[model samples]
Target chain A: MAIKEGIRTGGRSARVQASVHAAVRELLKEQDRASLTVPQIAARAGVTPSTIYRRWGELAALLADVAVERVLPDVAPLDTGELRADLRAWTEQYLDEITSEPGRNLMRDVLSSACPGYCTNILRGQLQVILDRAQARGEALPDIERLLDLLVAPTVYRTLFAEAPPTLEQLYSLLDLALPGQDPATLCHCDHRRR
Target chain B: MAIKEGIRTGGRSARVQASVHAAVRELLKEQDRASLTVPQIAARAGVTPSTIYRRWGELAALLADVAVERVLPDVAPLDTGELRADLRAWTEQYLDEITSEPGRNLMRDVLSSACPGYCTNILRGQLQVILDRAQARGEALPDIERLLDLLVAPTVYRTLFAEAPPTLEQLYSLLDLALPGQDPATLCHCDHRRR
Candidate 1:
């Protein structure tokens, strides 16, 4: 079943997916998300409701598919020549995006889906790019797993469940903790405490 | 509505809730979860299905309520006199419980429910007890929010989504990170790494 789906991801199927996703994005921006229905989405996408049902299973699954696409980083994280600067830049931008209202909704949709690994891998890949850049520059590399555990996990957990999102200072502190002895002063321009 | 529910918790309503929850727990152990229904649960508890629905709203919510009860730390975390030992003992026990098969299922039920905050607060409260104990001992207290972000968040994220649950060593390492300058050698008996 998985292979069959994989085989059909081109030409007509790909076009249908792209249009359907675009329609969902536009509709989500313009209307209340709770009011969205399959038929409305199909009409907007120039497809029948049956087409959506046959391809994506249901509204929740379809939303998850679109969310998975949106959350996946389309490009490498920005390179700032220094490891601390690069990590700060990438992490700050990441924190900003995921904690936004739309990003939180996307997170919920993706989590509700059967597959969360797709989004997890996208995040890990982006972090890996930054780590690789640091290594290439002969800077001491921070452990990726540590970064995930200490930084990404907290950021995500707080975003999803905590009363409020973590601040920029909190993010910098986490980065400092994750990469001990890395000079927190050089990590960010903000006047947060340096451990 | 909330006030009404609170007022009703003392008499027949409480008994019905107790019996239903007990029935659900028993049935879950004896049968496949997907096959069990409200009718079966109601029959086992000697109550009508309508009673279960009226009180709990639905099967998912009922399951979540039961899970929330199960996961709440019934007693204070062990006080081993020292701050590091107390943290290790509490966190290790927590990790062992929540990463088990039944624990994972309970986590899913709680998260799927409308009020994840109930479970989140329970966890935070448990950690706060550990921290408060440390403070009374004149031990420098680790920030509770930092502990939640660094320790609880990663433990949960890994339990819910990662390919594998984090190991005892990983938990120790996180504890070490969250409370830096604390002697890692004394944190856990296992020889993972000091730094």
Candidate 2:
């Protein structure tokens, strides 16, 4: 292959790896996740098939890694003093992505895979990476990770695969019930503001 | 269909519709949302192809209606005194449903669908039915309805459809951020919360 060779780890290598990474990202954007083949990656990267395969076992693995990498930085979530603001920001970013052609296409192919384990594994890994980051920052309340999952899981399920939007109003409503830091006793009560 | 044609409501004819409904519900219990079809539904009901299409338009519509109907009272959600307790109860129920054959199957199929609008309609309708009833009883927090879409949508998407399950920790945390009712400034963030 004429494009590049070997994993470049040094300062110069960073540029090469960046190129490879960019190629991978570009492939994902252009092709359906299901249709992605090593030949294509190699052709696009100007690298050998062995290089792509050696670097990543399969397309799903590569896509999973790339998805985690590319998606997080832009939409990784902001946790200011308030959870709602942070989440709204998070939701807005995700909304843009999922509704986008590339994101929607990528998710559809990924979720439609026959192997349930793979689907679960990639999504779990991607989520954990972001959630762990949020938690480490002290922005996460107890069960904040669960909040992230609950808030998001249903919307996607209802939308991408189920093929419905499930009303933004109701979705946001559920989010209010689910976000973080509120005392359960108060939430449970009719009067509510005992604080 | 002849099992109770003469009788109405609780009799044999009604029993058959009941059986069809039950079978549909049970099938949802046992399969992934990804692996559904009219033949499958018919087989599950021990009925013929004509019986299904004659009665229902398509697999999506039938499943949508059946799944929606079953989502209501068949599995009671949390109405306990404390919000956290109720949330825990609800989460527990969701966990049970998802883990069950029908729950997993139905969810998988629903989330796997490509038509976002259609899925949205079904889930929105289902959520509305559930929330409306809860609201009428005055147990539901006013703002929670609006956020409900954000909260539950993501969970479904994240779990069977997205990359991971919303960890129990996330769920608990989200409830806290949500339930306390917003401050005056925060109140303006959402238009529907005024009720």
Candidate 3:
């Protein structure tokens, strides 16, 4: 994160930016996202509140920058040659990542911001990775964009609002419904059907 | 509301509860949900903070009661006797309700609370109405429980996080994807396919 932040603008300005980003991340580790304030962030970073205000204008903007620059890129889906396997594996990992204390906080911070096209853009890219690999193997995939509603939205909803996040079993159940006749058991060793 | 509260208990206690709920709803009309504080709520409700604290213990618990008793139940999905039309109409109405300032605040309040099973309980009941009607008409449906992911999640996600909520057009697009063989145009007069 420091390297990426520093690479954009070298020297003291870059150092300040890195520190601010670092401070945001560090504070997130110890506290809820809603509790974070600009003055607190500035104090943690050893920069004046004016510096943060001048650079990012608002907490939301700073959080958006952190998301685009640091967080979303790390959420890229991996290629495993098979679409179903890749999706199931990716979904599990994605859930694990997002439901973690820091991950949930960071995601909530990003989503709560008014950054137009950020969530869909990052999600589309991730889904595209899985889709492209599926299409390469001559599998007839549905419209990649349409799959977002089926694949991404539910898990996100449960994570944010429901008392507990959707279990892997529940996710597999959704996949079974979405891709009828595409047995999830064939894709992975997990016997979610028994559950 | 007073009548409903009074039925549960009676007299001054019921009046106090009614006043507090009314105050929360009224205050929500003018301000964003995140900005509301317990002291402000107490002042508006014409009650002491100690009374509120003693009764509800925290802002989240109080908000959860408001959601359960008032907001969520009002989101009942209607039965138009046509599954696709009913789903679309319900989704649109639900979207309108949730995205409204007061609706959004109440929903955010309920979600941010530690209330277990509240979201799914309400949403499941709503979705079940549409599903039961669809099945009764001899339309083969996917697993009823899993449908929430496809039907409800995307709209909630876009409403809370995205720059814009999902349009009726985008929703039809999703329905088209979910119910592959069923044309939304055939079910309703709206010609989404031409788009």
Winning model by DockQ: 3
The runs of at least 3 residues in candidate 2 whose Cα sits more than 4 Å from the true structure, single-residue gaps closed, are A1-36, A64-93, A112-158, A161-195, B1-50, B60-84, B99-104, B114-147, B161-164, B167-169, B177-195
Model 3 alpha-carbon drift over 4 Å, by segment: A1-58, A64-76, A136-138, A176-195, B1-20, B23-58, B67-76, B130-142, B173-195
Q: Chain A TM-score of model 3 versus the true structure?
A: 0.61
Q: Score the docking of each candidate (DockQ).
A: 0.20, 0.23, 0.30
Give lDDT tens digits, candidate 2, residues A27-58: 76787656878787778777778766666665
lDDT of each: 0.73, 0.52, 0.68
Candidate 1 colliding pairs, count: 0
Question: What is candidate 1's lDDT per residue for A1-195, written digit by digit as tens?
Answer: 011121125699789888999999999999987899999999999999999988877787787767656664466788999888888888888788788776777766765666545456667778888888888988877788888886777777777766566788898888876774455343322223332
Worst ten in a row by lDDT for model 1 chain B: B1-10
TM-score of each: 0.67, 0.55, 0.66
- Rank candidates, TM-score, best first: 1, 3, 2
Model 3 TM-score is 0.66
Per-residue lDDT of B114 in model 1: 62
Worst 10 residues of 3 chain B by lDDT: B1-10
Clash-forming residue pairs, model 3: none
TM-score of 1: 0.67
